[model samples]
Target: MTSQNSRQTLIIPALGGLYARLNDGVETLLRVIAGGFLAVHGSGKIVDPFGASEMVEGLGFYPGAFWSPLLAATEFFGGILIALGLLTRPAAFAGMIVLLVTVWFHWVTMGQGFSGAEKSLLWAAALAFFVVRGGNRHSIDARLGKAF
Candidate 1:
C-alpha cells in the first residue's frame, strides 16, 4: 500500500481512541464556562434593564428597550441551550452575535479593546466545533437519536 493508505490505516483507530476522550474533556469544560458566562451576563441585563437600555442605545441598535429584552433572552436562553448541549450551534451563533455587538459597542464606538474576547472566542470556537461534530458521542442529540 502507498504511504497515504498506510497512514490512514494507522491513523483512523488512533484518532478514534484519542478524539473522544479529548472532545469529552474539552466540551465539558467549554459548556460549563459558556453557561456560566451567559448566566452572569444575562442576569445582569435582566436585573438592570435601564443600564442595558443605555448600552443598547450606545450600540445604536434602535429601540433600546427592545434590545435589552432580546439581548437578555439571547444570553439567558442561549446559555441554557449551551448548558444542555441542545441546539448548541444556533445558541453559539446567537452568542457570537451578542458578543460581536458588545465588542462593537465597546471597541468600535467606545474606542477600546479591553473586554477580552478570549472567552467569547473560545466559546464560539467550541460551539462551532459542536456544530460540526453534531454533539456526537455525548450529547442530548445523540441520546435522543439512540432512544428513538
Candidate 2:
C-alpha cells in the first residue's frame, strides 16, 4: 500500500480510537467548565441568599422569599453536583430551567434580545444536553452504575 493509504488505514483509525477513549473525559471537562462557571457566577447570591429576590420577582416569579434561595441553591449546590457528576441530570435540568428564565428576562424584559441572552441560551443548551445524556463513564453516576 502507498504511504497515504497506510496513513489513512493506521493513523486515522488510531486517532478515532483515541477520541472514543477520551470521550468521557471530554464530557467531564465540559461539565466542569459549565458547572464551575455557574458556581462562581452565583457565589454572591449564595452568600446573601436574598440578593436575587428583587430581580427574580421582577421576572414575575413572585414570592421572592422562596425563589431567591431556591435560585441560589440551584446555581451553587446544583453546580457542585454537576461538577461532581453526582445526580447530574437533576442538577443540569434545574440549571437549564434557571438559564431559560434568565434568557427570557434578558430577551423580553431587558430588551437585550439575542445578543444579551446568548450566553444563557448557550448555557441552557449545555445543561439540556447533560440532562439528556446524563453523566458519562468518567462521572460519579457511571461509577455508581446509575445516571438518574
Among these predictions, the greatest TM-score belongs to 2
Lowest summed lDDT window (length 10), candidate 2: 1-10
Identify the runs in model 1 with alpha carbons over 4 angstroms from their true place.
1-20, 114-123, 131-134, 146-148
TM-score, cand. 2: 0.88
lDDT of 1 at 27: 68
Computed on alpha carbons, the lDDT of every model, listed in order, comes to 0.67, 0.89
State residue 12's C-alpha deviation in candidate 1, in Å.
16
Per-residue lDDT for 117 in model 2? 100
Model 2, position 76: C-alpha lDDT score:
94
Task: Tell me the tens digit of each residue's lDDT in model 1 across 2-73.
Answer: 356445655457665565457576766667577667867788776766567776876777788888888888
lDDT of 2 by residue, 1-148 (tens): 3356445656456576676567678888999888889888779889999988998888888899899999999999999889889999999999999999999989998999999999999999999999998877778888999879
Please give each candidate's TM-score.
0.71, 0.88
lDDT for model 1 comes to 0.67
